[model samples]
Target chain A: MGRTLAEKVWDAHVVRQGEGEPDLLYIDLHLLHEVTSPQAFDGLRLSGRPVRRTDLTLATEDHNVPTTPGPITDPISLTQVHTLRRNCEEFGIRLYPMGDAEQGIVHVVGPQLGLTQPGMTVVCGDSHTSTHGAFGALAFGIGTSEVEHVLATQTLPLKPFRTMAITVDGELADGVSSKDIVLAVIAKIGTGGGQGYVLEFRGSAIRALSMEGRMTVCNMSIEAGARAGMIAPDETTFAYLEGRDHAPRGEDWDAAVASWRELHTDEDAEFDAEVVIDASELTPFVTWGTNPGQGAPLSHSVPDPATMDDTERQSAERALEYMGLVAGTPLRRIAIDTVFVGSCTNGRIEDLRAAAAVVKGRRVADGVRMLVVPGSARVRLQAEAEGLDTVFTEAGAEWRLPGCSMCLAMNPDKLAPGERSASTSNRNFEGRQGKGGRTHLVSPLVAAATAVRGTLSSPSDLEPLEPLVPAADLAHQEA
Target chain B: MDAFTTHTGTGVPLRRSNVDTDQIIPAEYLKRVTKSGFEDGLFAAWRKDETFILNDPTYAAGSILVAGPDFGTGSSREHAVWALMNYGFRVVVSSRFADIFRGNSGKAGLLTAQCSQDDVELLWKLLENEPGTSVTVDLVSRTITAGDVVAAFDVDEYTRWRLLEGLDDISLTLRHEPDITAYEQLRPAWKPVTG
Candidate 1:
């Protein structure tokens, strides 16, 4: 039998596989941030073990750093960042500090630097580490204990993961995007559907998405209960890595591509489970409840709990109460207090461009606040160079520096109690943004359009702006 | 990691499904560098309500958590495990558990026992009907017993062995250092390196 993409990568990275014992897989790249690495480093220190592979391990200050330019004001946040810097220095690992140009979310920094390549194994302490799996890598998140194990041994003894094929076919409609497609998939499969499996997103619709879009889709794999998600490498993947900072150069680049080309599932390969989605059938989807799976199409009304089974009905009831929503209400009529347009999920330049296009001639709603945080300093610079920042700021939105701002709300950017938001980031779990903060997961286009309307909306909901005529054109018309 | 062969304690029935890591330990408590001292942060948001199960004096000393399906559903933060352990929970019984959370619990010595949905419902009824009902989770026998209502659970052989023996994963992997070095040497030179 032929091997699947996940099986190929997993087999290639196995250092030791014994009968009745879990395989010990070697890690190629290890990404670290402040929130989860301190304990791992401490464990290494107590064990008197130095890092096994400094060249393969990278660290950054993201989760606890302030996105706004200035010193970190929170004492606890400051300590965590400072501890990471000290640990990296002591352990001889490369670290991108808060003010450094390379500083950003670890998941974003990995791909932008060309460190996360196809056919590699990437591990991080944050759940969004699955973001790197867009490059046909077998990447997943590990706990602090496993983080220490990887740092000391560069290998993890992991049981084999069941393979799942999530095939999305057909072209998306005008305003639908990868975010909506993934949201629709999660809604179809309950939150626990993908547990213990590594999902390989396949078919025409997935192939048509941009690298940024693919990353956005893979970043939320964890929200669907899958520890990791992958997409086979293709021309799009190679093109994105061509001249990156750490990308293979000279003759090596051709050799790298040749290997990556072989990183797809063979024709006769079989998956443990399969799910098929028609992209054409999807619309702008948004989460109406506390979990990602509890979502519906933007054009639909809030679902009544009585329509569901007993367990689902009870869960929906709790979600409705927490979300402060009434059944039978149109989703478009739901108002929002904030609009967040950044995270590892959708904080790339393309995401910013998509939002900038929507907000070009429109103004933010009277009382709604919108924040446009870049995923990395490099992404921030790229957006500024293209005048995307001006487009956002000119329209009354806050264009801030790079870091995970409100996605997990570890920093100062947070929502107050009873405040609601249309967020481009993943995860709508209860209190994910902040205490009592309600989030509706959305795409950048939807986030921007929602900011302009102060309600849950899609780009199609926005009316075309009235074109402004130049003075000369007006005078000519008058003549 | 301590060896966890068996544990007996009162059970706290958390009726909510999809109880995510953020609800287990909110993001604010994650700022601490140390792993210990997260007891106060465990269910910090839910504990604000006076009627929460943990607030009841009968279940205040409970060391086992009988929660709805899909427990520990989001985030890879091990702080959730640390917080639960700090708050005196040694075992979590659920019909279903998120993969990463179950793995983190195994490494941290927190037993995540998976039983059938019917068994979970029965356990919940028993615990809720009489708060502070004694529940016992035996890893060796792979069973959960509560007031003459005994239910068999499912746990993989390898993880169960590691937990019963209290083995360290790092030390075990280091035993195969020669194999790792050989594999590294054969790796393609085109693979990117951070430095």
Candidate 2:
């Protein structure tokens, strides 16, 4: 049988494979962040081993750094940030410190800087490392020990993963996005459905999305219990990487594209499992329960436990209680205390533009708190250049710098107990955002609309944002 | 990482599905600069109830965790494994485990053994019915057993060997450095690399 995309990439990177032994695969890139790198650095130090390839290792101060333009306030968070800086310097590994233009969530920074590329083996200590798989890389999160392992030796011992094909056909409806599509996929396949599998998202819908959108889809692969998710790199992927900061230039670029073109699954490639989703049937998806998989289209009401199967009914009931929702509550009627439009999942420039388009003429709801955080300093600067910051500020959203603010809440940006939020971040596990906080995952468009309505709203619920009017023309029109 | 040969200890049944790494060791506790001493942070939030399985005096000394399906479902924090190991858990028994969590457990010399749901439930029942039920896990035989409850388990041969030999992955991979260097040389010159 022809090998799948993952198998191709996996086969290429294997240094050695024994009959009963796990494969020893070479790692091309290692992305590190504050929270998970300290112990790894310590492990390398205690063993007196220098990083095998500092040129291939990159570190960034994220996870615990404040999004606000100031020094880190939390002592614990501050210590972690400092440790990473010291470690990076000691190890001669390049670091994108907070406030640096390149500094952002590692997932966002890697692709933007062209550090992640097609047909590479990428490993990070954060679960969202799967985000890099959008570029057709065999990327997955490794634990701190594995982080040390990769740093001390540019190879990781691995067990081969089963390949799964998640095929979605047809075009998405208006307002529906990659986030909605991924949520729908998770809902179809429960959280544990992708266990021991590397999902190769294929078909028309996967091929049609922008590079950013594809990243959003693969970013949540872990939420479905899959360690990694990927989309075969194509023309769009090549276009996105063409002139990136670290991307190859001129003749090298052509050669790179030529090589990347061959990364697709072969005509006769075999997948261990397959799932099909209809793109046209998808709607503005939202999670009514605590977990990412506990989601349905906004048009659908919170599922009634009585109508669900026995095991599902039990989980639904518990989810409902934790989410502070009635079994039959209308998902659209659920009000949110906050609307956060940023995270590695949707904090890219495209996502910011989408949110800006929705909130151009609308203000945040009476009691809702809206926060618009860019994924990186580069993104923040770009947003400012395009006046996205002004649009968000005028919409009553607090515009802030980016470093994984509120996604995992290791920083100061966190929800208080009992607060509910419509978030663009991945994961809604209990206490994920905060101790007793609740989060509903949504697309940037939905986050903007929800901020305007103070409820789980889609673009249809608000006054349509007007077409681009010059700042000079807007004041004249007011007269 | 210590070699995990054969461990015979009391098992504590934590019957919760999708028990993620966030709950195992919260993100707040992840700020520590070192990996050691995470025992205090294990199940930090859940310990508030004073009734959580690990907190009960009857299960205080338990070294085995018998959990429901999909255990360790979120995050790649190996600190979860460190915390579990620090709290004296030799093995985590579940019907299923998230790939990364199981891998982390193996890397840390903490065993993650898989069994059928029926077998898992039987183990849970044994642990719950007989508090401090001593279940013997024999890695050599790949079986877990307690009074009236016995079941075979599965652990990949490579991971089993690593745990038994206390082999460090770095040392193992370094043995094939020349192979990786050769593969690197064959790569297209156009391929972008990090700096």
Candidate 3:
């Protein structure tokens, strides 16, 4: 029987498998954060089990940590951070506390530190652990109990999943980036299309993408109901891994590459399901309904309920009612109340630059509340160095600090009831931003354009502008 | 943690991917810490329609959830499992299940079954066309039985045993007091484990 890439990975990781029983697979890395770990640590304490391998565990404060560099202002936030620090210290686990230059979102820090190298089975109490699968690894999120399971036993029992191949073939059009491609993939597949499947993104289009782009694509696989999305580690993967702090160095680098090169699906590989998308046909997409799958091309019109299936018809009507949109109206003309330009999905420096280019000179629409948040402190610093923050602020967008801000309403960043936003985040489920708050999924460029137009607009809708003058030159001109 | 519960109801098929906990039960519901009465908020966002699947009279009393693969992904909010169980769902059958969701469901005593994608699709379509059809999920056998298909699933032995017995972590731990006490005493005071 031929096996797909996912089967190959699962087969290699399986420690023991029994009929009608889950496989007990060894976990190589366990990442923890404040929000989910407290309970897991508690479970271990109650069980009187010590952390099996402190070396394999790494802790970071991300969810509750203040995005600002200053000390936390909220008492609860301060207490949570303090608790995590104390817990890590007592457990002999390594922690990158807030303000550490290396500290960031656990997902981003893992890859940047080269701790997310290929072939490792990584588990975090965070869903975005799927982000690490871009390196050709088996990564998944765990619950508090399973977190304790991994912490105490360094393994988990998992039911194997079927494999699905999402092949985005042909060349992407200019300005259509990996972000747009992923959004398009989500739109076509709907939210649950990849459920119960390990999706292997293959074909020429996937091979041509850069490592960061590949990471961006894989990062949102969970959003599309896939266990994890992966691309074969290739020359691009090797180039990205060549000079990282944790990556193999010198002679070992060559040896590591030799192994990684063979990680691709064999020619005889078989998949349970396959979705072939023509990359050239995709356009910048935005969600009209409340979910990421409710997206359509920016040029298309909002769907009318009468045309939908009986099950979906009423909900479509309600979405249109809540979003204050009219059926059959061009999606481009649908007005937006807010525009959010950050999240794990699109908060990288490159994402910031792409948005900044569109919003450089044109101010945001008068009534639109725009926000630009970086994914991490590192991304923030890079964006500031590039003066992208200034461009965002100068265009009437609020420049906020890092953390999973508006991406979720977890922290102070939340949308009021009945508010609508054009967001660069992954999920657009109803009130995902806030209670009764509607979300329109778009790329960073689309987010910026929508901020300017107060409507769902794509970068192509805007005319190209002359490059911005450097900050120094602009300052000199002002002076 | 109650046990030996039997679930019976019409099943609704939610054929969407990446239907996360946030979608299952929004964060607004989490403002209230009391975990008991969250059934109303289960899929609240999707309940905008009077005829919504969950709200529809035909599937109103259904306790089994036939969902798509990767059934619950993103976030480890126990509220999702709580919401589903509170909303009267005892089992969630998908082709693939997210790790955190599966654990959270098991912890909540809600059985999560992993069947083949084909089996799941067949069941979903069956329920979609026939709303009142009953799907039986037997935790002991780790099998999901609909009209024509009988699909065996995978579950950890301990979780399966606990669910069948209706015991929680705290209760389970209390069952072996001597071993726990001995293990704690062997460790020095300097090494404190917190659960």
Candidate 4:
């Protein structure tokens, strides 16, 4: 049988494909965070061993970091952050701790530093390690035990997995973004669609998206039930790698690109299974029900339980019960209590600008609370330097420091019980924001419009953004 | 008991994508500490609707799950895998599985198979007409086979051993009790106390 891209990659990295034993595979990068690493580091200390490969390992603090820059006033959070710093110091592992300009969400910092390159195997203790797959690497999250295993051994023994391919074809509509595309896919396939497969996003629509867009799409692959989602390295990939901090500089640049060019699927490559979605038919999507898969086009009505089959009717009914929404109601009319415009999935600078463009001259709804968090400290500084912070504050949105705030309720940021929010994060599961908190998954533009009207809305609902600079001068504008 | 086993490592084919932990096992089901009894909540939202794939007669339940990209995105709920396994899915095949969900699945004895898009498409196409189509998942061979197609797959080693031995995580940890206890007892008195 012809080897698929996954097989080729797996085979190339295999030190030993053992008999009835797991393959001892080499990992190219290992990311660490505060919450999960302290214990692993403790284990290493107890064992009297060094972190096997410090060069391959990197650490950062994000989960417990405060949204405001200062001494973390919260005692518990301060301790966690302090513990991580001490641990890293004792172990000699490089750490980007809280308050450090480089410190931010591990997923966000990885790409900005350009450590996330194509065709590598990346592992982190956090589940969102799937975020790194945007670079076409075989990145995934490891548990504390696995973290220890990787720290001590440097290599992991892994069993091979079945392969899968998801092809998004055609050109997306003008207003549709990567966020909408992934939502549409989850809606089509339902949740749990890709249970034991690794998804390779392919075709015209995927190819046309920018690296940020591809990252957004791949970042949510975990939401779709796949092991990891990836896009092959291409010119866009090479372009994003250039000038990145850890990217090959000067002499090594050409060689790196040449190798990445070979990372594509062979002509006769075969996948174990496949899915094809027509991007042209897709529209800006939003979740009406609780899970990410319980979504419909923004123009569609809330699903009526009476009209649904037995399998979905209860969820529809329960969603209406929890969300305080009525069956047959227009999704456009669904009111929101809060608007959150950040998470590892959508907290990048581009996402903020997209939301800011819609909220620029508008005021948030009378009672709605709007929060915008940058994914990293770097992103936060850039946004502030550009006065996007003022734009957000002027629109009545709270401008906060970078962290994985509200993405999961690990930190102080959380949804009050029973409050409903239009969020840019990937998941909208019951109580995901907090106990009994209702969430609606939306794009940054949709999130911004929702903040303005206090209900779900699309970018088209707002007037076109005024040009910040002349189109002709854009080429000369420093990014 | 005849040492009977007709099962392949093959998993159910679920075509849905973006499956969060709440859908896999709602929070209401997580009130308990035990790992069992979660199958009832696997796709609880969908189960609420009788027409969901889990309830659909044609694809009521199977081992291999074939889905779209981003299979286990969102949250670190281990219940997601427990629910899938409790619901009788031994293997889950997706183009992409969330990193957290994959680790959780391995710990719970559920196989998360990562395949290429092209091969995954072939599997789905091949199985579309025959929902009961049997695909062999050989952990030893690191291969999945259905009809004439054979696709090799990957899983972390520690997880593979635990699953093949039918060892639950607690038991696996208990297997090293001597080592763990010995280390604890050997902690130097000069070491500062900490949790």
The best candidate by TM-score is 1
Can you rank all candidates by lDDT, best first? 1, 2, 3, 4
User: For residues A23-70, what per-residue lDDT tens digits would candidate 2 score against the true structure?
Assistant: 888888899998888888898888899998898888898798887888
For each candidate, the alpha-carbon lDDT, in order, equals: 0.93, 0.89, 0.76, 0.75
Candidate number with greatest DockQ: 1
Report per-candidate TM-score of chain A alone: 0.98, 0.97, 0.93, 0.93
Candidate 3: list runs displaced more than 4 Å.
A68-79, A466-479, B1-20, B28-74, B83-100, B112-162, B165-195
Per lDDT, the best of the predicted structures is 1
Model 3, span A54-87: residue lDDT tens: 8778887677654545777766566667777887
Q: Using DockQ, rank the candidates from best to worst.
A: 1, 2, 3, 4
Candidate 4 residue-wise lDDT, B12-104, digit = tens? 455554555656765445433344687876776567777666675666657777775566666665657767777778777776676567776
Whole-model lDDT for model 2 versus the true structure?
Answer: 0.89
Candidate numbers sorted by TM-score from highest down: 1, 2, 3, 4
Q: State fnat for each of the candidate structures.
A: 0.86, 0.79, 0.25, 0.16
Model 2 lDDT tens row, B95-141: 89999999889888899989998998898888888898899999999
Q: Encode model 1's per-residue lDDT on A54-170: one tens digit a residue.
A: 999999988877778899999999999999989999999999998899999899999999999999999999888999999999999989998999999999989999999999999
The global Cα lDDT (0 to 1) of model 4 is 0.75
